[model samples]
Target: MSPSPDTSTDTSADDVMEALVRSAFQVMGVMTRISAEHDLSLTQLRVLGILRDRRPRVTELATFLGLDKSTMSGLIDRAERRGLLKRGKNPHDKRVVDVYLTPAGHELEQRLTDEFRRDLAPVVDRLPHHQRVEFTRLFEPLLSPPLVIKPRVTPQR
Candidate 1:
Protein backbone atom coordinates (compact mmCIF):
# COMPACT_ATOMS: atom_id res chain seq x y z
CA MET A 1 0.00 0.00 0.00
CA SER A 2 1.11 3.61 -0.68
CA PRO A 3 2.20 5.70 2.26
CA SER A 4 -0.13 8.43 3.50
CA PRO A 5 0.74 12.10 3.05
CA ASP A 6 2.20 13.73 6.15
CA THR A 7 -0.27 16.54 6.69
CA SER A 8 1.07 17.10 10.21
CA THR A 9 4.25 18.69 8.85
CA ASP A 10 4.44 22.44 9.21
CA THR A 11 3.76 24.52 6.10
CA SER A 12 4.15 27.94 7.61
CA ALA A 13 5.58 30.91 5.72
CA ASP A 14 8.98 30.55 7.42
CA ASP A 15 9.01 26.85 6.67
CA VAL A 16 8.18 27.52 3.05
CA MET A 17 10.95 30.09 2.81
CA GLU A 18 13.45 27.64 4.28
CA ALA A 19 12.34 24.96 1.86
CA LEU A 20 12.65 27.39 -1.03
CA VAL A 21 16.21 28.25 -0.01
CA ARG A 22 17.14 24.61 0.21
CA SER A 23 15.50 23.91 -3.14
CA ALA A 24 17.44 26.77 -4.66
CA PHE A 25 20.67 25.18 -3.50
CA GLN A 26 19.59 21.88 -5.01
CA VAL A 27 18.85 23.64 -8.29
CA MET A 28 22.27 25.25 -8.20
CA GLY A 29 23.90 21.90 -7.67
CA VAL A 30 22.09 20.53 -10.70
CA MET A 31 23.05 23.56 -12.75
CA THR A 32 26.69 23.17 -11.76
CA ARG A 33 26.76 19.54 -12.75
CA ILE A 34 25.14 20.15 -16.13
CA SER A 35 27.16 23.28 -16.83
CA ALA A 36 30.44 21.47 -16.16
CA GLU A 37 29.86 19.45 -19.32
CA HIS A 38 30.47 22.60 -21.35
CA ASP A 39 33.76 23.38 -19.54
CA LEU A 40 32.28 26.75 -18.58
CA SER A 41 32.04 28.31 -15.17
CA LEU A 42 28.69 29.46 -13.73
CA THR A 43 29.80 33.08 -13.75
CA GLN A 44 30.73 32.81 -17.42
CA LEU A 45 27.36 31.31 -18.26
CA ARG A 46 25.61 34.06 -16.29
CA VAL A 47 27.60 36.77 -18.06
CA LEU A 48 26.70 35.31 -21.43
CA GLY A 49 23.07 35.16 -20.37
CA ILE A 50 23.15 38.85 -19.51
CA LEU A 51 24.92 39.73 -22.73
CA ARG A 52 22.41 37.72 -24.72
CA ASP A 53 19.61 39.80 -23.26
CA ARG A 54 21.22 43.23 -23.61
CA ARG A 55 24.54 44.89 -24.28
CA PRO A 56 25.71 46.25 -20.98
CA ARG A 57 28.77 48.30 -20.15
CA VAL A 58 31.55 46.55 -18.29
CA THR A 59 30.92 48.62 -15.19
CA GLU A 60 27.20 48.00 -15.47
CA LEU A 61 27.79 44.29 -15.64
CA ALA A 62 30.12 44.48 -12.70
CA THR A 63 27.48 46.29 -10.68
CA PHE A 64 24.71 43.90 -11.70
CA LEU A 65 26.87 40.89 -10.97
CA GLY A 66 28.02 42.29 -7.64
CA LEU A 67 31.62 41.71 -8.59
CA ASP A 68 34.53 44.06 -8.42
CA LYS A 69 35.72 45.66 -11.66
CA SER A 70 38.89 43.55 -11.80
CA THR A 71 37.05 40.27 -11.28
CA MET A 72 34.40 40.99 -13.91
CA SER A 73 37.08 42.15 -16.32
CA GLY A 74 38.92 38.88 -15.86
CA LEU A 75 35.76 36.92 -16.49
CA ILE A 76 35.03 38.93 -19.60
CA ASP A 77 38.60 38.45 -20.76
CA ARG A 78 38.38 34.70 -20.39
CA ALA A 79 35.02 34.47 -22.14
CA GLU A 80 36.26 36.74 -24.91
CA ARG A 81 39.24 34.46 -25.42
CA ARG A 82 36.87 31.50 -25.72
CA GLY A 83 35.09 33.28 -28.60
CA LEU A 84 31.89 33.35 -26.60
CA LEU A 85 31.75 37.12 -26.15
CA LYS A 86 32.96 40.28 -27.78
CA ARG A 87 33.64 43.67 -26.34
CA GLY A 88 33.03 46.67 -28.52
CA LYS A 89 32.71 50.40 -28.15
CA ASN A 90 29.16 51.46 -27.55
CA PRO A 91 27.64 52.99 -30.70
CA HIS A 92 26.19 55.94 -28.84
CA ASP A 93 29.26 56.59 -26.80
CA LYS A 94 32.69 55.61 -28.03
CA ARG A 95 34.10 55.79 -24.52
CA VAL A 96 31.63 53.26 -23.21
CA VAL A 97 32.47 49.60 -23.75
CA ASP A 98 29.72 47.08 -24.29
CA VAL A 99 29.75 43.33 -24.08
CA TYR A 100 27.65 41.09 -26.34
CA LEU A 101 27.20 37.43 -27.13
CA THR A 102 29.00 35.87 -30.05
CA PRO A 103 27.49 33.07 -32.13
CA ALA A 104 29.36 30.49 -30.12
CA GLY A 105 28.04 31.97 -26.87
CA HIS A 106 24.49 31.68 -28.14
CA GLU A 107 25.10 28.06 -29.08
CA LEU A 108 26.54 27.28 -25.67
CA GLU A 109 23.61 28.97 -23.99
CA GLN A 110 21.20 26.81 -25.98
CA ARG A 111 23.08 23.67 -25.09
CA LEU A 112 23.19 24.55 -21.39
CA THR A 113 19.49 25.34 -21.41
CA ASP A 114 18.76 21.95 -22.94
CA GLU A 115 21.01 20.20 -20.45
CA PHE A 116 19.30 21.89 -17.49
CA ARG A 117 15.90 20.85 -18.81
CA ARG A 118 17.09 17.31 -19.26
CA ASP A 119 18.50 17.19 -15.74
CA LEU A 120 15.21 18.30 -14.20
CA ALA A 121 12.85 16.45 -16.53
CA PRO A 122 13.01 13.10 -14.77
CA VAL A 123 12.32 14.47 -11.29
CA VAL A 124 9.64 16.80 -12.56
CA ASP A 125 7.98 13.96 -14.46
CA ARG A 126 7.88 11.83 -11.34
CA LEU A 127 6.19 14.46 -9.20
CA PRO A 128 2.54 14.02 -8.29
CA HIS A 129 0.08 16.43 -9.87
CA HIS A 130 -0.49 18.52 -6.76
CA GLN A 131 3.21 18.57 -5.88
CA ARG A 132 4.07 19.61 -9.41
CA VAL A 133 1.55 22.43 -9.22
CA GLU A 134 2.96 23.57 -5.92
CA PHE A 135 6.50 23.46 -7.30
CA THR A 136 5.51 25.63 -10.22
CA ARG A 137 3.78 28.13 -7.97
CA LEU A 138 6.87 28.36 -5.81
CA PHE A 139 9.42 28.62 -8.60
CA GLU A 140 7.62 30.98 -10.97
CA PRO A 141 8.57 34.00 -8.88
CA LEU A 142 12.29 33.25 -9.06
CA LEU A 143 12.34 32.91 -12.86
CA SER A 144 10.01 35.77 -13.73
CA PRO A 145 11.12 38.81 -11.75
CA PRO A 146 14.63 39.87 -12.65
CA LEU A 147 14.91 43.01 -10.56
CA VAL A 148 12.72 45.41 -8.65
CA ILE A 149 14.00 48.92 -9.29
CA LYS A 150 11.69 51.71 -8.27
CA PRO A 151 9.57 53.56 -10.83
CA ARG A 152 11.39 56.00 -13.08
CA VAL A 153 9.05 58.91 -12.44
CA THR A 154 8.72 60.45 -9.01
CA PRO A 155 5.70 62.29 -7.60
CA GLN A 156 5.88 66.08 -7.57
CA ARG A 157 6.96 67.48 -4.18
Candidate 2:
Protein backbone atom coordinates (compact mmCIF):
# COMPACT_ATOMS: atom_id res chain seq x y z
CA MET A 1 0.00 0.00 0.00
CA SER A 2 1.16 3.55 -0.75
CA PRO A 3 2.02 5.75 2.20
CA SER A 4 -0.67 8.27 3.04
CA PRO A 5 0.29 11.94 2.80
CA ASP A 6 -0.36 14.06 5.84
CA THR A 7 -1.55 17.61 5.31
CA SER A 8 1.09 19.38 7.36
CA THR A 9 2.09 22.96 6.60
CA ASP A 10 4.79 23.28 9.25
CA THR A 11 8.23 21.71 9.12
CA SER A 12 10.27 21.09 12.24
CA ALA A 13 13.80 22.41 12.75
CA ASP A 14 15.12 18.85 12.84
CA ASP A 15 13.52 18.16 9.48
CA VAL A 16 15.05 21.27 7.96
CA MET A 17 18.49 20.45 9.37
CA GLU A 18 18.33 16.91 8.10
CA ALA A 19 17.26 18.01 4.64
CA LEU A 20 20.00 20.64 4.39
CA VAL A 21 22.72 18.28 5.57
CA ARG A 22 21.67 15.57 3.14
CA SER A 23 21.56 18.05 0.28
CA ALA A 24 25.00 19.35 1.14
CA PHE A 25 26.39 15.84 1.13
CA GLN A 26 24.83 15.17 -2.24
CA VAL A 27 26.42 18.31 -3.69
CA MET A 28 29.77 17.52 -2.12
CA GLY A 29 29.78 14.09 -3.69
CA VAL A 30 29.39 15.63 -7.11
CA MET A 31 32.17 18.12 -6.39
CA THR A 32 34.49 15.37 -5.14
CA ARG A 33 34.15 13.45 -8.36
CA ILE A 34 34.75 16.56 -10.45
CA SER A 35 37.80 17.54 -8.43
CA ALA A 36 39.24 14.07 -8.81
CA GLU A 37 38.85 14.30 -12.58
CA HIS A 38 41.12 17.34 -12.49
CA ASP A 39 43.63 15.53 -10.23
CA LEU A 40 42.99 17.93 -7.38
CA SER A 41 42.12 17.45 -3.75
CA LEU A 42 38.73 18.67 -2.57
CA THR A 43 40.49 21.28 -0.47
CA GLN A 44 42.44 22.48 -3.50
CA LEU A 45 39.24 22.73 -5.49
CA ARG A 46 37.80 24.76 -2.61
CA VAL A 47 40.75 27.13 -2.78
CA LEU A 48 40.08 27.71 -6.44
CA GLY A 49 36.45 28.44 -5.71
CA ILE A 50 37.40 30.83 -2.90
CA LEU A 51 39.91 32.67 -5.05
CA ARG A 52 37.52 32.95 -7.98
CA ASP A 53 36.13 36.25 -6.75
CA ARG A 54 38.23 37.72 -3.97
CA ARG A 55 41.89 37.96 -3.13
CA PRO A 56 42.48 37.39 0.57
CA ARG A 57 45.60 37.38 2.69
CA VAL A 58 47.36 34.07 3.33
CA THR A 59 46.50 34.10 7.04
CA GLU A 60 42.90 34.88 6.27
CA LEU A 61 42.72 32.05 3.76
CA ALA A 62 44.14 29.65 6.30
CA THR A 63 41.64 30.74 8.92
CA PHE A 64 38.73 30.47 6.52
CA LEU A 65 39.83 26.99 5.50
CA GLY A 66 40.38 25.95 9.13
CA LEU A 67 44.02 25.10 8.49
CA ASP A 68 46.99 26.18 10.56
CA LYS A 69 49.57 28.50 9.04
CA SER A 70 52.08 25.77 8.17
CA THR A 71 49.54 23.46 6.62
CA MET A 72 47.92 26.24 4.68
CA SER A 73 51.35 27.30 3.46
CA GLY A 74 52.01 23.78 2.24
CA LEU A 75 48.75 23.65 0.31
CA ILE A 76 49.43 26.99 -1.27
CA ASP A 77 52.98 25.94 -2.05
CA ARG A 78 51.73 22.89 -3.95
CA ALA A 79 49.17 24.89 -5.88
CA GLU A 80 51.79 27.49 -6.74
CA ARG A 81 54.16 24.85 -8.05
CA ARG A 82 51.38 23.58 -10.25
CA GLY A 83 50.87 27.16 -11.54
CA LEU A 84 47.27 27.19 -10.36
CA LEU A 85 47.72 30.18 -8.10
CA LYS A 86 50.21 32.81 -7.07
CA ARG A 87 51.03 34.89 -4.03
CA GLY A 88 51.81 38.58 -4.19
CA LYS A 89 52.37 41.36 -1.74
CA ASN A 90 49.24 43.17 -0.68
CA PRO A 91 49.21 46.64 -2.26
CA HIS A 92 48.32 48.40 0.97
CA ASP A 93 50.68 46.36 3.13
CA LYS A 94 53.97 45.20 1.68
CA ARG A 95 54.39 42.74 4.55
CA VAL A 96 51.06 41.02 3.88
CA VAL A 97 50.73 38.47 1.08
CA ASP A 98 47.58 37.81 -0.89
CA VAL A 99 46.71 34.71 -2.88
CA TYR A 100 44.87 34.79 -6.18
CA LEU A 101 44.19 32.37 -9.00
CA THR A 102 46.25 32.35 -12.19
CA PRO A 103 44.63 32.49 -15.61
CA ALA A 104 44.90 28.70 -15.89
CA GLY A 105 43.31 28.38 -12.49
CA HIS A 106 40.45 30.66 -13.48
CA GLU A 107 39.85 28.67 -16.66
CA LEU A 108 39.81 25.41 -14.75
CA GLU A 109 37.53 26.88 -12.13
CA GLN A 110 35.10 28.02 -14.80
CA ARG A 111 35.11 24.58 -16.41
CA LEU A 112 34.55 22.91 -13.07
CA THR A 113 31.70 25.27 -12.30
CA ASP A 114 30.12 24.50 -15.62
CA GLU A 115 30.42 20.79 -14.99
CA PHE A 116 28.91 21.21 -11.55
CA ARG A 117 25.89 22.99 -12.95
CA ARG A 118 25.52 20.38 -15.66
CA ASP A 119 25.74 17.53 -13.19
CA LEU A 120 23.27 19.14 -10.82
CA ALA A 121 20.81 20.02 -13.57
CA PRO A 122 18.90 16.78 -13.24
CA VAL A 123 18.23 17.29 -9.53
CA VAL A 124 17.39 20.95 -9.97
CA ASP A 125 15.18 20.22 -12.96
CA ARG A 126 13.14 17.90 -10.78
CA LEU A 127 11.67 20.95 -9.16
CA PRO A 128 9.12 23.03 -11.03
CA HIS A 129 10.28 26.47 -12.17
CA HIS A 130 8.40 28.42 -9.52
CA GLN A 131 9.61 26.11 -6.76
CA ARG A 132 13.18 26.43 -8.06
CA VAL A 133 12.92 30.21 -7.88
CA GLU A 134 11.48 30.00 -4.40
CA PHE A 135 14.17 27.55 -3.34
CA THR A 136 16.95 29.93 -4.45
CA ARG A 137 15.26 32.85 -2.71
CA LEU A 138 15.00 30.92 0.56
CA PHE A 139 18.54 29.51 0.40
CA GLU A 140 20.44 32.67 -0.60
CA PRO A 141 20.31 34.20 2.90
CA LEU A 142 22.00 31.18 4.51
CA LEU A 143 25.10 31.57 2.31
CA SER A 144 25.93 35.23 2.74
CA PRO A 145 28.61 36.11 5.38
CA PRO A 146 29.09 32.38 5.91
CA LEU A 147 27.92 30.54 9.02
CA VAL A 148 29.95 30.19 12.18
CA ILE A 149 29.18 28.36 15.38
CA LYS A 150 31.17 29.27 18.47
CA PRO A 151 31.62 27.04 21.45
CA ARG A 152 29.73 28.00 24.57
CA VAL A 153 31.66 28.29 27.81
CA THR A 154 30.07 27.54 31.15
CA PRO A 155 31.26 29.17 34.34
CA GLN A 156 33.05 26.85 36.74
CA ARG A 157 31.35 26.33 40.10
Candidate 3:
Protein backbone atom coordinates (compact mmCIF):
# COMPACT_ATOMS: atom_id res chain seq x y z
CA MET A 1 0.00 0.00 0.00
CA SER A 2 1.16 3.56 -0.61
CA PRO A 3 2.12 5.61 2.46
CA SER A 4 -0.20 8.36 3.52
CA PRO A 5 0.75 11.85 2.45
CA ASP A 6 2.42 14.15 4.99
CA THR A 7 -0.18 16.85 4.36
CA SER A 8 2.06 19.31 6.21
CA THR A 9 2.55 21.96 3.54
CA ASP A 10 2.35 22.26 -0.23
CA THR A 11 5.84 20.71 -0.23
CA SER A 12 6.15 16.99 0.52
CA ALA A 13 8.92 15.16 2.38
CA ASP A 14 9.89 13.55 -0.92
CA ASP A 15 10.56 16.99 -2.31
CA VAL A 16 12.87 17.77 0.56
CA MET A 17 14.64 14.44 0.19
CA GLU A 18 15.10 14.95 -3.52
CA ALA A 19 16.48 18.43 -2.96
CA LEU A 20 18.95 17.09 -0.42
CA VAL A 21 20.17 14.45 -2.89
CA ARG A 22 20.57 17.01 -5.62
CA SER A 23 22.44 19.33 -3.29
CA ALA A 24 24.86 16.50 -2.54
CA PHE A 25 25.47 15.96 -6.21
CA GLN A 26 25.96 19.68 -6.82
CA VAL A 27 28.44 19.87 -3.95
CA MET A 28 30.29 16.87 -5.37
CA GLY A 29 30.53 18.56 -8.75
CA VAL A 30 31.92 21.70 -7.20
CA MET A 31 34.46 19.65 -5.26
CA THR A 32 35.38 17.76 -8.40
CA ARG A 33 36.13 20.96 -10.25
CA ILE A 34 38.24 22.28 -7.41
CA SER A 35 40.12 18.97 -7.18
CA ALA A 36 40.72 18.95 -10.90
CA GLU A 37 42.37 22.33 -10.57
CA HIS A 38 45.01 20.40 -8.63
CA ASP A 39 45.00 17.51 -11.10
CA LEU A 40 43.65 14.99 -8.57
CA SER A 41 40.87 12.49 -9.13
CA LEU A 42 38.02 12.33 -6.63
CA THR A 43 39.15 8.99 -5.23
CA GLN A 44 42.73 10.16 -5.04
CA LEU A 45 41.66 13.27 -3.14
CA ARG A 46 39.55 11.12 -0.81
CA VAL A 47 42.44 8.77 -0.07
CA LEU A 48 44.80 11.67 0.61
CA GLY A 49 42.29 13.32 2.93
CA ILE A 50 41.84 10.08 4.85
CA LEU A 51 45.57 9.60 5.19
CA ARG A 52 46.15 13.22 6.25
CA ASP A 53 45.28 12.70 9.87
CA ARG A 54 46.45 9.15 10.40
CA ARG A 55 47.38 5.92 8.65
CA PRO A 56 44.95 3.05 8.22
CA ARG A 57 45.18 -0.51 7.01
CA VAL A 58 44.16 -1.20 3.42
CA THR A 59 41.21 -3.26 4.66
CA GLU A 60 40.20 -0.52 7.07
CA LEU A 61 40.41 2.08 4.31
CA ALA A 62 38.35 -0.19 2.08
CA THR A 63 35.65 -0.51 4.73
CA PHE A 64 35.66 3.20 5.55
CA LEU A 65 35.51 4.20 1.89
CA GLY A 66 32.83 1.56 1.06
CA LEU A 67 35.08 0.08 -1.60
CA ASP A 68 35.93 -3.56 -2.24
CA LYS A 69 39.39 -4.78 -1.21
CA SER A 70 40.56 -5.29 -4.78
CA THR A 71 39.49 -1.80 -5.79
CA MET A 72 41.17 -0.33 -2.73
CA SER A 73 44.35 -2.24 -3.58
CA GLY A 74 44.37 -0.80 -7.08
CA LEU A 75 43.78 2.70 -5.80
CA ILE A 76 46.59 2.29 -3.32
CA ASP A 77 48.88 1.00 -6.03
CA ARG A 78 48.22 4.04 -8.21
CA ALA A 79 48.67 6.45 -5.32
CA GLU A 80 51.98 4.78 -4.41
CA ARG A 81 53.23 4.99 -7.97
CA ARG A 82 52.47 8.71 -7.93
CA GLY A 83 54.64 9.16 -4.81
CA LEU A 84 51.64 10.22 -2.76
CA LEU A 85 51.73 7.24 -0.39
CA LYS A 86 53.90 4.51 1.01
CA ARG A 87 52.76 1.07 2.09
CA GLY A 88 54.51 -1.05 4.66
CA LYS A 89 53.81 -3.88 7.05
CA ASN A 90 51.84 -2.84 10.10
CA PRO A 91 54.09 -2.72 13.13
CA HIS A 92 51.44 -4.46 15.17
CA ASP A 93 50.64 -7.07 12.57
CA LYS A 94 52.95 -8.15 9.80
CA ARG A 95 50.03 -9.48 7.77
CA VAL A 96 48.31 -6.10 7.66
CA VAL A 97 49.56 -3.37 5.32
CA ASP A 98 49.52 0.23 6.59
CA VAL A 99 49.54 3.27 4.32
CA TYR A 100 51.49 6.43 5.15
CA LEU A 101 51.75 9.77 3.43
CA THR A 102 54.95 10.88 1.78
CA PRO A 103 56.18 14.48 1.84
CA ALA A 104 54.65 15.00 -1.59
CA GLY A 105 51.37 13.72 -0.22
CA HIS A 106 51.54 16.27 2.57
CA GLU A 107 52.09 19.12 0.09
CA LEU A 108 49.24 17.92 -2.13
CA GLU A 109 46.87 17.63 0.82
CA GLN A 110 47.78 21.14 1.95
CA ARG A 111 47.10 22.56 -1.46
CA LEU A 112 43.80 20.73 -1.76
CA THR A 113 42.72 21.95 1.68
CA ASP A 114 43.55 25.57 0.91
CA GLU A 115 41.74 25.44 -2.40
CA PHE A 116 38.66 23.89 -0.84
CA ARG A 117 38.59 26.42 1.97
CA ARG A 118 38.82 29.30 -0.47
CA ASP A 119 36.07 27.84 -2.64
CA LEU A 120 33.73 27.22 0.30
CA ALA A 121 34.38 30.38 2.30
CA PRO A 122 32.41 32.75 0.12
CA VAL A 123 29.46 30.39 -0.17
CA VAL A 124 29.34 29.91 3.57
CA ASP A 125 29.71 33.65 4.22
CA ARG A 126 26.67 34.39 2.08
CA LEU A 127 24.40 32.60 4.55
CA PRO A 128 22.77 34.61 7.31
CA HIS A 129 24.83 34.90 10.48
CA HIS A 130 22.43 32.83 12.57
CA GLN A 131 22.16 30.20 9.86
CA ARG A 132 25.93 30.06 9.57
CA VAL A 133 26.33 29.62 13.31
CA GLU A 134 23.63 26.98 13.47
CA PHE A 135 25.03 25.14 10.46
CA THR A 136 28.49 25.05 12.01
CA ARG A 137 27.05 23.78 15.29
CA LEU A 138 25.06 21.08 13.53
CA PHE A 139 27.97 20.07 11.31
CA GLU A 140 30.46 19.63 14.15
CA PRO A 141 28.56 16.83 15.86
CA LEU A 142 28.23 14.92 12.60
CA LEU A 143 32.03 14.75 12.39
CA SER A 144 32.62 13.99 16.04
CA PRO A 145 33.01 10.50 17.56
CA PRO A 146 30.68 9.35 20.30
CA LEU A 147 33.14 7.01 22.03
CA VAL A 148 36.25 7.51 24.13
CA ILE A 149 39.67 6.59 22.87
CA LYS A 150 41.95 4.04 24.50
CA PRO A 151 45.72 4.03 24.11
CA ARG A 152 47.31 0.94 22.67
CA VAL A 153 50.79 -0.50 23.10
CA THR A 154 52.20 -3.04 20.71
CA PRO A 155 54.14 -6.04 21.96
CA GLN A 156 56.99 -5.24 19.57
CA ARG A 157 57.26 -1.65 20.75
Candidate 4:
Protein backbone atom coordinates (compact mmCIF):
# COMPACT_ATOMS: atom_id res chain seq x y z
CA MET A 1 0.00 0.00 0.00
CA SER A 2 1.15 3.58 -0.80
CA PRO A 3 0.58 6.69 1.26
CA SER A 4 -0.71 9.95 -0.24
CA PRO A 5 1.69 12.87 -0.51
CA ASP A 6 1.70 15.62 2.12
CA THR A 7 0.09 18.84 0.84
CA SER A 8 0.22 20.85 4.04
CA THR A 9 2.82 23.37 5.08
CA ASP A 10 3.00 26.14 7.67
CA THR A 11 3.21 29.09 5.28
CA SER A 12 3.70 32.39 7.00
CA ALA A 13 2.38 35.69 5.69
CA ASP A 14 5.92 36.94 5.13
CA ASP A 15 6.77 33.80 3.19
CA VAL A 16 3.71 34.26 0.98
CA MET A 17 4.58 37.91 0.40
CA GLU A 18 8.14 37.00 -0.53
CA ALA A 19 6.93 34.39 -2.97
CA LEU A 20 4.58 36.87 -4.62
CA VAL A 21 7.28 39.52 -4.91
CA ARG A 22 9.76 37.06 -6.35
CA SER A 23 7.16 35.80 -8.82
CA ALA A 24 6.47 39.39 -9.91
CA PHE A 25 10.17 39.96 -10.51
CA GLN A 26 10.43 36.80 -12.60
CA VAL A 27 7.45 37.81 -14.73
CA MET A 28 8.80 41.35 -15.15
CA GLY A 29 12.17 40.02 -16.22
CA VAL A 30 10.53 37.96 -18.94
CA MET A 31 8.43 40.92 -20.07
CA THR A 32 11.42 43.25 -20.08
CA ARG A 33 13.42 40.90 -22.28
CA ILE A 34 10.53 40.45 -24.70
CA SER A 35 9.91 44.21 -24.81
CA ALA A 36 13.56 44.91 -25.56
CA GLU A 37 13.58 42.40 -28.41
CA HIS A 38 10.84 44.49 -30.04
CA ASP A 39 12.68 47.75 -29.27
CA LEU A 40 10.16 48.87 -26.65
CA SER A 41 10.55 50.03 -23.08
CA LEU A 42 8.56 48.15 -20.46
CA THR A 43 6.19 51.11 -20.13
CA GLN A 44 5.64 51.19 -23.88
CA LEU A 45 4.88 47.47 -23.81
CA ARG A 46 2.39 48.07 -21.02
CA VAL A 47 0.73 50.86 -23.00
CA LEU A 48 0.23 48.49 -25.92
CA GLY A 49 -1.36 45.95 -23.57
CA ILE A 50 -3.67 48.59 -22.08
CA LEU A 51 -4.78 49.88 -25.47
CA ARG A 52 -5.52 46.43 -26.78
CA ASP A 53 -9.20 46.57 -25.88
CA ARG A 54 -10.06 50.05 -24.65
CA ARG A 55 -9.85 53.55 -26.09
CA PRO A 56 -9.18 55.66 -23.04
CA ARG A 57 -8.78 59.41 -22.81
CA VAL A 58 -5.25 60.69 -22.38
CA THR A 59 -5.81 61.73 -18.77
CA GLU A 60 -7.47 58.44 -17.92
CA LEU A 61 -4.69 56.41 -19.45
CA ALA A 62 -2.11 58.53 -17.69
CA THR A 63 -3.83 58.02 -14.34
CA PHE A 64 -4.08 54.30 -14.94
CA LEU A 65 -0.34 54.13 -15.56
CA GLY A 66 0.51 56.46 -12.63
CA LEU A 67 2.22 58.85 -15.02
CA ASP A 68 1.89 62.62 -15.12
CA LYS A 69 -0.19 63.90 -18.04
CA SER A 70 2.79 65.49 -19.73
CA THR A 71 4.90 62.37 -19.34
CA MET A 72 2.10 60.22 -20.70
CA SER A 73 1.69 62.62 -23.61
CA GLY A 74 5.36 62.33 -24.46
CA LEU A 75 5.18 58.56 -24.35
CA ILE A 76 2.14 58.66 -26.59
CA ASP A 77 3.84 61.07 -28.94
CA ARG A 78 6.79 58.72 -29.39
CA ALA A 79 4.51 55.76 -29.93
CA GLU A 80 2.47 57.72 -32.44
CA ARG A 81 5.62 58.53 -34.38
CA ARG A 82 6.35 54.81 -34.48
CA GLY A 83 2.85 54.24 -35.91
CA LEU A 84 1.88 52.04 -32.95
CA LEU A 85 -0.89 54.25 -31.67
CA LYS A 86 -2.89 57.34 -32.48
CA ARG A 87 -4.78 60.10 -30.73
CA GLY A 88 -8.19 61.30 -31.80
CA LYS A 89 -10.93 63.47 -30.44
CA ASN A 90 -13.50 61.45 -28.59
CA PRO A 91 -16.72 61.03 -30.59
CA HIS A 92 -18.90 61.62 -27.56
CA ASP A 93 -16.82 64.49 -26.27
CA LYS A 94 -15.01 66.30 -29.02
CA ARG A 95 -12.90 68.23 -26.53
CA VAL A 96 -11.42 65.04 -25.09
CA VAL A 97 -8.59 63.16 -26.76
CA ASP A 98 -8.62 59.36 -26.75
CA VAL A 99 -5.86 56.88 -27.55
CA TYR A 100 -6.25 53.84 -29.73
CA LEU A 101 -3.94 51.12 -31.00
CA THR A 102 -3.09 51.05 -34.68
CA PRO A 103 -3.26 47.75 -36.55
CA ALA A 104 0.50 47.57 -36.38
CA GLY A 105 0.35 48.13 -32.65
CA HIS A 106 -2.15 45.30 -32.32
CA GLU A 107 0.15 42.99 -34.24
CA LEU A 108 3.09 43.90 -32.07
CA GLU A 109 1.06 43.46 -28.92
CA GLN A 110 -0.02 40.00 -30.07
CA ARG A 111 3.54 39.03 -30.81
CA LEU A 112 4.70 40.24 -27.42
CA THR A 113 1.93 38.31 -25.72
CA ASP A 114 2.82 35.16 -27.61
CA GLU A 115 6.49 35.53 -26.85
CA PHE A 116 5.83 36.21 -23.19
CA ARG A 117 3.64 33.14 -22.91
CA ARG A 118 6.22 31.05 -24.66
CA ASP A 119 9.01 32.27 -22.45
CA LEU A 120 7.02 31.80 -19.26
CA ALA A 121 5.70 28.41 -20.21
CA PRO A 122 8.53 26.50 -18.60
CA VAL A 123 7.98 28.14 -15.24
CA VAL A 124 4.22 27.73 -15.44
CA ASP A 125 4.49 24.16 -16.64
CA ARG A 126 6.28 23.24 -13.42
CA LEU A 127 2.96 23.28 -11.64
CA PRO A 128 0.56 20.39 -11.99
CA HIS A 129 -2.55 20.92 -14.09
CA HIS A 130 -4.82 21.28 -11.06
CA GLN A 131 -2.39 23.62 -9.33
CA ARG A 132 -2.16 25.76 -12.45
CA VAL A 133 -5.94 26.11 -12.61
CA GLU A 134 -6.08 26.95 -8.93
CA PHE A 135 -3.27 29.47 -9.27
CA THR A 136 -5.08 31.27 -12.08
CA ARG A 137 -8.35 31.30 -10.16
CA LEU A 138 -6.59 32.82 -7.14
CA PHE A 139 -4.78 35.43 -9.22
CA GLU A 140 -7.72 36.59 -11.33
CA PRO A 141 -9.34 38.56 -8.54
CA LEU A 142 -6.16 40.54 -8.03
CA LEU A 143 -6.41 41.87 -11.60
CA SER A 144 -9.86 43.38 -11.12
CA PRO A 145 -10.41 47.16 -11.25
CA PRO A 146 -9.63 49.01 -8.07
CA LEU A 147 -12.48 49.73 -5.72
CA VAL A 148 -13.42 53.39 -5.39
CA ILE A 149 -14.60 54.62 -2.03
CA LYS A 150 -16.45 57.91 -2.28
CA PRO A 151 -16.41 60.23 0.69
CA ARG A 152 -19.61 60.84 2.56
CA VAL A 153 -21.11 64.33 2.45
CA THR A 154 -22.39 66.04 5.60
CA PRO A 155 -25.45 68.27 5.17
CA GLN A 156 -25.33 71.69 6.84
CA ARG A 157 -27.91 72.16 9.57
Alpha-carbon RMSD to native, per candidate: 10.3, 7.5, 10.4, 9.5
On lDDT, the candidate that comes out on top is 2
TM-score (C-alpha) between model 2 and the true structure:
0.85
lDDT by residue (tens digit), candidate 4, 61-141: 888887778999999999999999999999999999999999999999899889988999999999999999999998788
Overall lDDT per candidate, in order of appearance: 0.82, 0.91, 0.82, 0.89
Q: TM-score winner between 1 and 4, please give it.
A: 4
Worst 10 residues of 4 by lDDT: 143-152
Tens-digit lDDT track of model 1 for 30-142? 87886687787887867866777799999888877777789989999999899999999999999999988899988888787787788888867899999989988977887
Candidate 4, residue 51: Cα displacement in angstroms equals: 0.7
Candidate 3 local distance difference test against the native: 0.82
The residue-by-residue lDDT of candidate 3 on 35-116, one tens digit each, is: 7887778888888988999889988887777777898889999989989999999999899889989999999898888877
> Total backbone clashes of model 3?
0
Compare the candidates by TM-score and give the number of the best one: 2
Candidate 2: the clashing residue pairs are: none
Candidate 4: TM-score?
0.82
Candidate 4 lDDT at 94 equals: 95
Q: Candidate 4 regions off by >4 Å? A: 1-11, 146-157
Per-model TM values vs. the true structure: 0.72, 0.85, 0.74, 0.82
Error of 4 at 60 (Å): 1.1
- Regions more than 4 Å wrong, model 2: 1-11, 148-157
Judged by lDDT relative to the true structure, which candidate is superior, 2 or 3? 2
